[model samples]
Target: MTMGFNESQSAFAAALLDPGLPLPQGITTARGVTDPLRFAVYRNNVYVGLTTALGQRFPVTKRLVGSEFFAGMARTYAADHKPATPLIIHYGDDFPDFIAAFPPAASLAYLPDVARIEVAWTRAYHAADRLPLDVAKIAAVPPERIAEMSLVPHPSAGLVRSDFPAGTIWSAHQGEAVAPVTEWRAEAVLVVRPAMHVEIRFLPPGDAAFAACLLEGTTLGTAAQKAFAAAPDFDFGSALIGLVGLGAFSAFEAFEGKLP
Candidate 1:
């Protein structure tokens, strides 16, 4: 009869997910009828809600794979992964990794990275608000110490690096596909919410290295040097302009005694 609280809960959860499972002993309607069909309605509702949440979070994945494939995939995903937290919005946190391991999706190697970018985009959208970097703060630092300074990234700053042209695939699915992705080169993606809207951007050859170094609290000189070594044609002045344009840095501080 599953009289214990813990055992009853386990039985109910299992039945709720699998309508074919018999209702646990001692559960009945007001009329004392054990109609297992009743549980099927709620089971369908739960899957529908969870699948909708996944669709919202990974719209690009849905678009690339088409609705039929995505729906089948989402249903399979829902059966195995239930939300532990009350907030279902965060349910698909491991969906990307799941896609990477799923046998049917083996052909779509970029799917995981695309999922990662979508996750980053949503996270950036919900990140805490913060003021952009005050350019005046850096101006106050002595010019000699500028190279030794470390800049703080904005609260919404996030990055995704993928070997499989993930950024290109993501961009292709954005609003009617402006252009095709002819070149299949590895790309690093930068995500930041400078204002209200989340912005996704692709980093140029050396910019990823520069941005990554800075993200790790590297001195400006070291980041630049590493970036330059990787791509001799790296443009420091242009990169600074782009960084300011994206409002990537939130603050600046002196980094003592550092070189690379």
Candidate 2:
């Protein structure tokens, strides 16, 4: 009997998921017979392709888990969560959450946060480009008006906070030899794509607070005030220079004005 549209789609999904399953109805085989082997080959190819794509998206997660474990997790993740978009580059948005609840990786509590950082890095690399705010413009603003002026964060800016030293772990794996001590303290990371490359930096608590406030549209003066509250020794001058050098500020305008 000819399968209906829904039935045909169901059959195709089943065949793709389980290579041992028979071919979907209305599909042909080379030998003019229902050859499960041919369909199995096709199913395996699909899995392989998806697995490779996931690996590329989460290379750090894969490396931390090792080849065998990474492959196994990738298989389970792929099966449960199929891509909604045809663009492979946009895949793996749910991977960080997947790693968090994955039974096999339950022991590595920091794995998910590390994955988040990697994902942010990838996203920043593809974010919209904009010319950094001119330093002269910022300097031109009157001291009296600076308190009401808001700074805009770059399009590619992202902040990550983790209980574990995710940035340290990620950096260590990338060829730096560092101790893997579990301090159980919060570490903040700032990611910005100033030019062609993505730059990752570990942010001090005060600086992170300041940056977060600025990103939320707070005036520069307000952000600095908050930073000083967080850390009495907060160095506004140094932090501003560092942020501007990293291209964190795309533009500045009056607090009520639209970002330029």
RMSD of 2: 3.3
**lDDT, each prediction:** 0.83, 0.83
After superposition, the stretches of candidate 2 with alpha carbons farther than 4 Å from their true spots are 1-23, 30-33, 176-185, 216-229, 258-260
Candidate 2, residues 23-58: lDDT per residue as tens digits? 788777766777767777888888888889989988
* Alpha-carbon RMSD, each predicted model: 3.7, 3.3
Give the per-residue lDDT digits (tens) of candidate 1, residues 1-260: 23798888888777766656887877788999876677677788988898889999999999888888888888889888878889776788889998999889999999999999998888888888988875555556677776778878888888888988999889878888547789998999999998988998889878888888887888888999999987899997577557756878777777454222
Task: Give the range of the ten consecutive residues with the poorest summed lDDT in model 1.
Answer: 251-260
Weakest lDDT window of 10 consecutive positions for candidate 2: 175-184
TM-score of 1: 0.82
